[model samples]
Target: MKKERAKVEEVSTTEEKYAQWKSQVPVLYDWFANHNLVWPSLSCRWGPQIEQAVYKNKHRLYLSEQTDGSLPNTLIVANCEVVKSRVAAAEHIEHFNEEARSPFVKKYKTILHPGEVNRIRELPQNSKIVATHTDSPDVLIWDIEAQPNRHAVLGASVSRPDLILTGHQDNAEFALAMCPTEPFVLSGGKDKSVVLWSIQDHISISAAADQGSTKSPGSGSSSVKQDSKVGGDSTTMSPSIGPRGIYQGHRNTVEDVQFCPTSVQEFCSVGDDSCLILWDARVGFNPVIKVEKAHDADIHCVDWNHHDENLILTGSADNSVHMFDRRNLTSGGAGSPIHKFKGHSDAVLCVQWCPDKSSVFGSAAEDGLLNIWDHEKAWKAKERIGTRTRSTSPGLFFQHGGHRGKVIEFHWNPSDPWTIISVSDDCDTIGGGGTLQIWRMNDMIYRPKEEVLAELEQFKSHLNTCK
Candidate 1:
C-alpha cells in the first residue's frame, strides 16, 4: 500500500517541479535533464502523466508525486487528498473559519456534463489579429492593427452571424468598450490615454462579446453609465455606453479595468502598484475606493458582482483570491476582504463569477487547474475550506486530478447558465491537446444523483413554506 501510494505521489511531485519551471521558460527540456528527471513523454507511453490541481478558495494546491523533483510541473502526481471544498461567501464578514488550501493543486472537478468546448471556426469576416480577451459576452472583438501579432484579439462576439468590434490602435492596449455612455464608447489602452468614439462612427466595428467574468450589472447598463434611456432591443450586439469621455487615472500600463455591473458610472482598476482603485467614468483620478496591499503578489484580474454591490472578486500573484466588500469600509479593516481565498500552489492567473450568479465563480492558476466554489459557502464555512497549516487534510467537493498544462483562463457562460469554457496555451498541462475544454455543472462531484436530488427537493419544499 505504501508503494502504491508512493508511486502516485511521485508522479504528483515531478509534474509540480515542471510547472514551476515552465511558468517562466515554456520549454522543460534543459531543466528536466539537469535534474536527472525522466521525461514522462519519453519514459511512459501514455504521454506525460497528468496531475490534479485544486484551488482552495483563491489559492491552489497541486498534488505531485512524492519525490524531490526540481521542476514543479514535472513532479509526477501524488496522492489525491481532498481538502476543504465549497466555501461560500457571506455578507459583510471578513473573518471566517473556512480552512485554507494551497493553490498549486486545486483538485480537478469531474465533469459529469462536458460542456460545448468548441473553438469558433466560422469567425466573423474581416477579423484582425488577436490582442486580449474581453467580457462583453456574445461577441468577441479584435484589434484592427496596422501591425499584427504584438497584441491582437481585441475582443469577440459570443455567437455566430456575429458583428465584430475593435479598437483602432497601432501598439497601444486600448480599452474598447462594446457599449459605453449613450451610443458612444471609450477606448483606453497602453497609449496612456482614452479615446471616445461613436459605436457606428467607426464603421470599422469588428465582431465581439467581450467574454469576461463580470459580477453584476444594472440589467444592460454600460460601464460609466452614459444615458439611462438607451435601446430596449440591444441584444448581445447592442452598444453598452453612451456619451464620450476618456477615463485617465493610472500613470502606467493599466493591467485591468472593469465596470461595475451594478452601476454603469462605476469602474475599477489595478495596475503597477499595490493599488486597487475604484472609478466612476463621471469623475477621474479620485477613486471611490482605494485598496492598498490588494495582494502580496501582483493583482492580475478583478471581477464585479452580478447582483450584490458590496461584493467583488480579485485574483493575484501572491497565489490567492480575495473577496472585497465595496459598500462597507469597516474599522476592523471592515473593508478588508470578507474572506481571502488561499489555495493556488502558484500565481493565480484569472478569476470570474458566473454571469448568471455572483455566488458562483471560477479561478485558474499557473499550476493549470480551474476551481469552482460557492462564494456563499466558502464565506459561511470559510474555516472548513482548505487544509489548515496544522493539519493536511482535504475537504469535500474537491477534484483530485485534472488538466495537463498551465490553466490560463476559464469563464462561466451566461447563455447556458451551467456551461463553462477554459482555454490554455500551456505546453504541458495535458500532454498534447492542452486544448480548450468546455464543462458544465454536473453530478460527477456530487455522486448519488438521486440522493442529491431528494435533498434539493426537500430544501425547496421547505423554502416554499417560508415564501
Candidate 2:
C-alpha cells in the first residue's frame, strides 16, 4: 500500500502534465499568424484541449478535440488567477455589496411596489407628494417625509399610500402628470383613455374612511362631529366619486400626455396612431388642434416648452426628435419640423424641458443614452449623459451606468436642481426588484472647472510617462 501511494504521488499534477504535453506538440504559430488568430496570453483553466487545429481564415477556423486523452497538441490556454490589487479588491467588494445585496446602496430613499412603476411625478411645489403610476390600474401617492437609514425601513414608514387613485379600466396605467396649479391628476393607460382625478376629493374620502374605522359605535355625538369635520360638506362627498373627466379619442394606446405649462385647461396627447392631439379640458372630447402623421413611426413622448408654449418637442420610434411650431400648422406654411435632432441610435423613449433652463432639454432613448440639447445650438447636443457607446457627440460630460436595463423615465427634482430621480426596468437591489435611482449631479462626472483641468493635467502626465 505504501509503494502504491508513492507511485500515485509521483504522477504529475494537471498543470505540470499539460506543460509537458504542450512542449512535445508542434506549435501552430505560422498557421495562427497567417489567419490572424493570435492566442491570448491570458490563460483559462477548464476548456476542451485541441486534438487538431486548422485555420481557414480570419473569421473562420476549425478545431477537433478528444474527450479523453493525454492533452492535445494545441496551444494551452491556461486559466489565469486574476488576483486583484488591494484597492481593486476593495472596490469589487464594495460594488458587490451595494449592487448584489441590500442596505448598502444609499442613493435609493424608498422603494414603492405592488407593480413596476411606469411614471413618477412630484406635485407642483410639493416634493414630498410624489405620484407614481404603476403597471396596476391604481396610482400610488407616496408621502416621502421620513428618510430611512436601512433598506428594511424603506417602505415601513410609508405605510399605505397617502391616497390611491383608481379610474382606468385597463390593468396598466402608462402615463401620469400632476397639474401644476390645481388639485388634479391626469393619467393615461393601455385602455386608450385619459382620466383626470381630483386630489382633494380622494384625500377627504380617505380621511373619512380612517375616521369611521377609529370612532366608537355608540358614541353618537363624537362620531357625528368627526364625520362632519372629515367629510367637509355633504354635497362635496359624493358616494360615487369618480374621475373628473375621461377623454377618449386616441385610436391606439396613449403613449404620453402632458398639460401645457402655461395653460392648465390645454394639454397634448400622443399615441401609437402617430397623431398629436391638443385638447382643452373644458371642451370635452373635442381636440383644439390635431396634427396627423406627427412622425413616421409611433410617437413616444411630447413636451411643451416651459418658456415658449408654441414650441413643442416630440420623440418618435423613427429615431428622430422633431421641434414643431404650433403656429405654423396651416395649409400653406413651413410643413416640416423647425429643427430635427437626430443622434440617438434607437427610438427616443422620453423627453423633458429643463425646469431651470428654457433653451436646454434632455432626451432619453432605448439605446440607454441621455442627451442634453440646447435650442440655440440647433441639432448639436450641448452635453451627453448616461452611456457613451452609441452617442455621436464626443462631449459627454456625465455618463451614468448604474441602471442595468433601459432607463424609461427620469425627472429633475424640483426642489433640488442638482438631484435627478430615474426609474429603470432592471434594478440592482435584491428586495426592490425594479427600483428608483436618485442621482445627484455632484456625485456624477460633472466636476468643477478646476478639478477638470487637474484631471486633464494628470492624464497628460500619465501619457508622457507611458511615452
lDDT of 1 at 140: 24
lDDT against the true structure, each candidate = 0.42, 0.52
Instruction: Please give the RMSD of candidate 1 to the true structure.
Output: 17.4
* Highest TM-score scorer: 2
Task: Give the per-residue Cα lDDT of candidate 1 at 49.
Answer: 18
lDDT of predicted model 1: 0.42
lDDT of 2 by residue, 368-401 (tens): 4556666764533333433334535333243334
lDDT for each residue of candidate 1 in 1-467, tens digit (9 for 90 to 100): 99878856755774776455334221211111011112221100001113334521121111111111232111111112222223212221122111222222233321110011111111112222221222221222233223121211112212211122233232233233323223333344454433333444323222223444342322222432111111112342333332244455555444455556645566666654545667666665355566766777567667777677677778887887888887665323225777777666777776777666557677787766667666666644646654445232122133212345556555453333444445444334323323333334333343456887887899999999999
Q: Candidate 2 regions off by >4 Å?
A: 1-112, 146-159, 203-241, 330-336, 379-404, 418-467
Candidate 2 at residue 17, lDDT?
A: 42
Using lDDT, give the best candidate's number: 2
